[model samples]
Target chain A: MAFYDSLFDSLGLREWCGAGDKGGPMTMAELLAKSKGTTATEETSALTLPFPSLDNLHAACEAIPRTRDMTSGVENFFLSIKSSLQFVLDPLTQPLSWLLDGSIWLFIAMPWWLLIGITLVAVYWITRSRASTILVAVTWLFLAFIDHYDYAVQTMAIIFICTGLSVLFGVPIGIAMSKNDRLQKAVIPVLDMLQTLPSFVYLIPLIFLFSVTESKLYGIAIILYAIVPVIRLTDLGIRLVDQDIIEAANAFGMTARQKLLSVELPLALPNIMAGVNQTIMMSLAMVVIASLVSAPGLGVLVLRGINNLELGVGLVSGFCIVILAILLDRVSKATLARVDVSQDS
Target chain B: MTANVKVSIKNLYKIFGPAPESVLEHAKNGVDKASLLDQHGHVLGLKDINIDMKDGEITVIMGLSGSGKSTLIRHFNRLIEPTDGQILIDGVDVMTLSADDLRKMRQADMSMVFQKFALLPHKTVLENAGTALRVRGFKAEEADVEARKWLDRVGLAGFEDHYPHQLSGGMQQRVGIARALTSNSAVMLMDEAFSALDPLIRTDMQDLLLELQKELHKTIIFISHDLDEALKLADHLVILKDGEVIQQGEPQNILLNPSDPYIEDFVSDINRSRVLRVRSVMQPLKEAASSTAGNVDYNDTLEDVISHSDGDTTKVYLVMHEGEPVGTLCMKDLVRALVPRVPSEESIRS
Candidate 1:
């Protein structure tokens, strides 16, 4: 009976009066009377011979055009538009190249040891732990000994810039998405596409539009890659806020903007901060990948060692990246912990 | 008693769905429930709710879950807009208020406490309490000062810096209450505000609310599912069921005579005499009562009157509203009042 029901449903025959009946075909009047809860004593069955086979079902289905054809057409249209955008953007990419070089040079010229010292102190102050401070200091010293400080600093600069941009752009987008369902629906597919696409795939079109020497090339790529976490976190944070709290805010006569700023945002701060942490981590991950395009960092050193077969250089560069990752992770985690503690008491 | 109604709601209907207005339009044309359901998956959250919340009175709307009690109160504050109705606050149609005006009305005239306490978890107790004032444009220092005063009023003076999650359920509710009161809104809407607390704490919170009401004289609209809480707190009680008002009257009247079988069933288990108090059911005391019975306090319960009297010819003393003697009762009358009636054998068997 279930199989027959499925067959009828698949064939779109359920809309007809005679379908879905197990007691053979019945007249429209008989079906209506049965639906109305009237008893029908007389039973008249109509048996038709030469039932249509599965091949006929398949043939009928093939006669109808599928929705996929329209989707593919839309996809091709978008592909063309993207390529056209890349062509227009190429000439504007050169000026950004000088800015990237200048920023890298500035970091390279700084007294690398002093930079490491100040970072250690800041980490210590933020985390408020002697062990974390010592670990940060030791990691920097080890990187300096291996002569990977310059590359590590370059990577740090990219992460700092990208993470900052991600927070700036992602938070507001998240807040907007939380407030408006239509905006959320519109933005979510884009976020999903960005998140699921391979990290290397992001650089392909970006490489076409922006020169590898441009700081904005890596900047834009890192932001695109890292922005999803912050946006998601912010949205989740605001969405997770108790509905009763929002209602309470409304009852208090808070304007929509006031409520978002004062109540919803404050309650969602932890989630947003967590998103910031994730964004930073993602930025660091993408910075290494950006090194392939001549963006300077520990990744550049690692790539150099791999290409030249210098085992010591690769290991040293890898160690520097780990130290940098620890520093950023510790500082952000400490900030988040402080937030939670302050909220508690 | 002659003060004009502060809030007047007429035929309020709040239906939740995309096409609520269209569905409501069909509903008014005598569309059957099934047809309405089929056309639009409309859930009648609130239906034809009419109420007048008098100035300085605590009106309690009581119902089981999904009975539209919460939705009805939400309509007055415009937290949830009614599909079709007129809600007048101080003679202004609340439904027609512009966004800015509505916000101003909320900030100045109404505040609400939620059952979950809804204290901002990120803000300190002081900041949470001061939020309403801050949003209404008070300066930081001024808001803090006012917030401290309300926090002190709610008995949390020393815990201003503490956050909401650090506080117990009752304490959190106190913070919520303080926040609502800090706004100094004439109308305070509390949605099951103390229902989440332990029984003892709930009683304390209830007492605190009564004390606050005594001093503030705010027009309070309190929503609760508990009948006892409603009876204890409300000046006027509105009983709702399935998006409709089943009964609305003074607590005393409703206790004495429930309007429908549903209400009768609802109040059937309630110990009426315990809630009624000496003031409600007291009669005139007679001069001759002093001869046969021991003198009982005029304010004592009937149970107290029964337990203290020891003699076989025990006479029940009647307490008058005023100081003068009015009437007396014997043991026979007291027994009749205390006993619960049982159905007859024939009726039970049938």
Candidate 2:
């Protein structure tokens, strides 16, 4: 019935193979116990199994594991650990929900004019460039004229909180990695995987772990997708500082904390700021994908358009997201240019 | 003279490798640097280095690149720990000090100037100069006042608010010197502090250092590759080769009577007439020489005496220390001193 049935019989494996007998599935333990008695007799052929013959063996023996069984086993293991994993992570991640909810409420509840005025002033103060401030103001007004103001504000609130959390946690991890070679060697591969993995894959696990109603369900997905660049750039920035200057800091008898705060951090700021700009852009990208999990904002409209075949809704929402991205990117880059002293002669 | 010893390095050995302690015996047993590296995969950084630096004098360590002169100076501040050695600074064993005490010593007792002028790029000149004081927890205003005084003294009065990158190489190094001075440390370690400057600026900095030394009287350890700079600045000169001290003493004594062929080769091409002072060449006299041409200061170079005598080989001049005659110099001895001693024929063949 199977390609491997006769070959297995010639090898004196017939008894273990469940040959010519239809049977239900059996556990791997019972299969191993039956196979342990297999021996080559005088009439048995001394032949090896060919490559990729495991599927044929599964067809011949009902006791052998099928590919689907292997996948199910993995799923079962994950399910076994899910409750314990949730028990530990739920407490640690609870505050992220509070931060996300609070910011979204505040951004939407503010008077429209007040929000616009305050945002423009903040951008102007950060960049000290009139061109960047004007770009942000115009982008916001266009979105408001099209009735996309509330959605844009919600997206901005998410990006702000996610980027802030990324920096708050990412910088210290990067600093610790820079100071220790062992820690750096261990962390670099993990960061590489996080950066290269498809952004949608981050949401798959978080969705299973947290309820879709909680803000942290999408918050965790966005933070995980966005945090990689800040960590990598912060580590690289500290490593790139001039060795001569580090020696001078040591020569001044600076304590470890003092050297890091006064010398290393100031020198590494421009690189970290560049990383922050990238993080903000990444957070906006992930927020759209996270709208599949009921995340509020422009992404929700984009999802609605896609699901319902509303070309105008999807196209306009996509255009609005692009506008928000450009505004954030330009403002942050202008601020970085101001902070980078080496750009001057 | 022994009581005046400010810093003493005794039997120091530095082997650089993964397992330096495992190969320490090989380095200690007089193994050559090359063989040690080839046999045990270790670099011999320094070997049995011993030198006593005196207080209120500049000890210039001169060597070619890779001679470990830079490595040697860092040991004083414990920046690079010696594999095996005892360093005594102000009569305290530097190796025995705790982390806190060592930081205190570095902050209050010793300061350094780097060859690359390692000023912070973001900070203004005033802030860079005051870094040492600020690190020691001095108030920002207090540190600024101290930093400003030294910056003014170094002729950087109006450039306090300018960033380091905005200054020239020489001016940045002046900020480095001002930083060291602001700390008011008793000992200064200058690692090729003028090597990065232009030739003209280098000369000006040398003169500035000598002038400052007259008033400060700090025990300074200077590292340089230039023999002319060494002869000009060093009260005690130490020459190194292959990370071992070849000869060290008064610069004039080392030049006049070089004991090794390496030392002989190093001093042969120097402008002897300009660098050799009258005090080193003159014959001491209890009374004034008869028929002396005129008076010459003991510190005058042979070039000065040559111009003063107008190339008169027969005329003799009394060497004056302060106002009294201490010795006499003749043009014949001056001419003889101008020629470097020929190396032994056997030394050349080897």
Best by TM-score: 2
**Candidate 1 local lDDT, B1-350, one digit each (tens):** 43668888888877788888878877667565556667778876777788898999999999999787877878888877789989998888998899989999989888889988888787889999998899899998999999999999999999998878889999999999999999988989999999899999999999999999999999999999999999989999999987888899888678667777677667766665466544444445535556545454455555666566653434655554356555665656555544333312323112
- Give the candidate number with the greatest lDDT: 2
lDDT of 2 at B134: 98
Clashes of 1: 5
RMSD of 1: 14.6
lDDT (Cα, tens digit) per residue for candidate 2, span A1-345: 555667667888777766445544654644675688743222323454434444456765655666657877888887888899999999999999999999999999999999999999999999999999999999999999999999999999999999999999999999999999999999999989988889888877787778889999899988988999999999999998889999999998999999899899999999999899999999999999989988899999999999999999999999999999999999999999989955343
Candidate 1 lDDT at A162 equals 70
Predictions' DockQ, in order: 0.42, 0.53
* Segments of candidate 2 deviating more than 4 angstroms: A19-54, A342-345, B343-350
DockQ of 2: 0.53
What value does the lDDT take at residue B118 in candidate 2?
Answer: 89
Give the number of the best model, judged by DockQ: 2
